[model samples]
Target: MSDSTTLVYKKKKKKFKIFPLVNAIFFIIVACLIMIPIYRVIISSIDANTSYNFVWLPSKFTWGGYTAVLTRSSLYTPFLISVVTTIIGTFVGLLVVTLGGYVLIQWEMPGRNFFAYMLLFTMIFDGGMIPKYLVIKQLGLMNTLWAVILPMSINVYNLVLMRNFFEGIPESLFEAAQIDGCSPMGIFFKIVLPLSKAALASIGLMFAVSFWNDYTNFKLYITKNKLFNFQIQLRNMVIDSDIPVDDAVNQETIGNAATIIAILPFMIIYPFCQKYFVQGVNVGAVKE
Candidate 1:
């Protein structure tokens, strides 16, 4: 066929579908619903004379809220505690997850099934709050960051995902490494880890987000104000509801700014790990 005729034929063959158009419209509406509130919060943070009022756009804009939030000594304690706990918590959690997952993959290990079942059982049932509090008190972890950090590492859902990811590794690689006289640990370090970057990144991000946003654990275990995390303090600011009209900025603006600051790390980190997250979620979802 002539080029023009072929082009005409292709154009004729292309029939627009209503489903795709409708789907696009639906997602666009959903995106706007999500982004509009975030945009409003950003505007409110810089707004002068801010209140619990809706701020679609700031009529009077200034950075006073950010300045107050960043410079305030009272806010500094929680921010620092959160940063420290998040870093330590993510590291400890990732270590436990990786090691635990690796152990589950070792078929010949005695009591493997028993241990796995126990882990799943713990997921469904936990010691009641009183017993948990007593344990933390007895262990001398109360009023410390370790109280929050330790519990953050024991997520059974993440454990299950890690095991599935390890299981997805090709059996041939395991047999080949054994034939080469590579110790199990050597194989884990050299072969398994290099292939499991996506899973690691995904699970690490999960752990980081969990630890960073933790308020309940910190509230329950740590009575000391000095050990409180950013989320706990943020809640305080929101509840106080006293906006100082005399000041350049008010608690309302700072509260909104604080909320943004709390979530900003993941906002920066997630885009880098997004591909790995998608791949890891898929790779770890193996059929039994």
Candidate 2:
């Protein structure tokens, strides 16, 4: 090649080496590294005892684990309980957080900063388990689904994210709505909310994941076996080895399967909202 052509090729190569392509490759590598264990868990769940040893690939695959856990496992009741709790908790928590966040951002209500600071304080410092338990007891919520939902209804960090999103909306739109004699509630429902779909979906998914993965609350307040969440059931399965096996329950493989099943919903839902999640994170990271 001519010297000039060689020099031009070297310049282009240098520019390519400095591009974000390197960072993207690095990110993919790190992501795959993190996901390997999760992938293994899913694989293990689909296979039977062939996975007992540390083989990288399963020699045989079966639906036994899923069938065992979903149909015949003793913990099926708890799985149902978890589904109910997650649904109820996510719905209630999302409504409360979004509505409260919207109000706090909009009204400039008296003592708003104090309330916000108090909420932020909770993020840093928690009432210890005992105190929180006592309060739940005092409220007569123990052994009830409300016990799970009420104490954690509004996460301060999530509220802050939602507030930032609300703040990002054009104030002029709100003003125009006000001139049309729209009430705060009407404006929130009709105008602000439609525009804030991305933020809401992101926050809702976060809350759903939190509620789904939570075992501590259920373990603490729900003494009744019927009230145990899926995490609690999985914990019990992992701890006890001699659990009964029926025609549908492959007791030997249920733990691994349960772990996979527990995480599958989040895996399915996250991709759909991933764009919104990134946007929400970037927007929330910036202080208004």
Candidate 3:
């Protein structure tokens, strides 16, 4: 009886995915394109010899550029100002994005759409630069860190991203939280926030970068030289030739060094936040 019927089974085949491999190669090329420029900047900063042309490797190396930037009194104040503004601006920006986003998601709340449309309207049109200046002047924020911080604190784009993320959260979770006698603030702190790590990191990074690299707002509102941030100091050093230079380092060298200092923080920071960052940007892109 066994000999009469022979069982047949087909062997499973392994499929090679060209898309993933192609994606890897594409990303590798992209990464090198990004990293090469950074490598050049770092090498240029360390290179003691003065030359405008880009070099793959430095002929001579020295730390004089970094030392000059770090030790110079002119650069120090601006650098500190940049750091302080970035920290305060990021915290305040997070508060604005989170609260405004949460408030907009409350469907039962009165005038929610009207309030949201008002915020969106500002994105399409705004009071001109003179009026903005007049308003800042009237508020007595001129020449202060707040002048820079407050202008950037309320970004409509970030608020919208956050609102989208909030909308993606299940309505069931909110209902359950309300059933447990959780107030609005309680649900925000205990439930909403715990689910929003990715959004916070991504938006926080955006705010940090914006405030850290801010140039126009500071240059506009801050007429006083003492209030300038590091970018301004770098501009004066590199472009305007306002700051005094040390004999040990060339102006270009100091500029490159300062450039490294300016971008280095984000380079270090981004890798730590990479996982959350990818998720955060794509938060509302897909549906389950």
Candidate 4:
């Protein structure tokens, strides 16, 4: 066919689908619904008024929430604690998972099947909270930040996903590395690690989120008020009603501020890692 005729045929073949267009509009509405509350909270942080309202644009804007939380409330120390723990936990957890996943995919490792079974076993079973508490107490981790970071550094589900991704890699690449006098560690760092960015970003973000939002662990294991994370303090104020009755300060406003502080890092981090997240989630979801 002539090029002009082919182009005309292709244009004729394209038809607008009402269902897809309607579906997209429906989801867009739902997305806006989900985002409205978050937008309100962000705006409320700078709003001077204590009462929540439906006003998209306030008559007067003030930095009262930010100022109150930062200057008066006990949020600063806990903010620092959360930042430190999240960074450390994410790095340590990623390293452990990446190497562990690489090893699980290796056919020559001794007791590889047995170890994989054991790892999978833990995913299905639980040690219970009492046993976990006892272990932490015995290790002198109580009231310490390590109490939270150590227990959940390696999530089994994330490890499994990482393994599935590594298994998808071509075995010939490993053989080529071996032929080039590359050690197992060298191959992992030089080849496997570089190629596994999607899985790493996905798992790393999971670890960071878990670490950042861990209030129950801190409440259970950490008694020292100074060591509490942002989530822990926020839980105390919002859930436990630990807010003191003070005429000068509004607890509700402070709670809203705390909510923003707790979730802002996640909001910022997701956009950067979202592309990798979608790809990584799909990598292990299908079987060829």
Give Cα distance to truth, residue 273, candidate 4, Å: 3.0
lDDT of 1 by residue, 1-288 (tens): 899999999988988789999999999999999998898889988887777777677877878877766666777888888889889998899888888999998999999999999999998998888898898889999888899899779888888888898998888999999999999999989998898999988988899899999988988998887778888877776677533334677777878887788888899999999999888877666644
Q: State which candidate, 1 or 4, has the greater lDDT.
A: 1
Q: Which stretches of model 3 miss by more than 4 angstroms?
A: 1-22, 242-248, 286-288
Model 1 / residue 178 / CA error / Å = 0.7
Model 4: per-residue Cα lDDT over 74-120, one tens digit each: 77788889999999989888888887888898888899999999999
Candidate 2, residue 106: how far the Cα is off, in Å: 3.2
Residue 250 C-alpha lDDT in model 1: 72
Model 1: how far residue 283 lies from native, Å:
3.3
Candidate lDDT scores, in order, read 0.85, 0.78, 0.87, 0.82
The predictions' CA RMSDs to the true structure, in order, are 3.2, 4.0, 3.5, 3.2
Of 1 and 3, which scores higher on lDDT?
3
lDDT of 3 by residue, 1-288 (tens): 353343222224456789999999999999999988888888889888757887998877888888877766788888889999999999999999999999999999999999999999999998889998999999999989999998899899999999999888888999999999999999999988898999999999999999999999998999988989988888877787654566666777777888988888888999999999988987656543
Candidate 1, superposed: residue stretches over 4 Å from native: 1-18, 51-53, 241-247, 286-288
Instruction: Please state the error at residue 205 of candidate 3 in Å.
Output: 0.8
Best by lDDT: 3
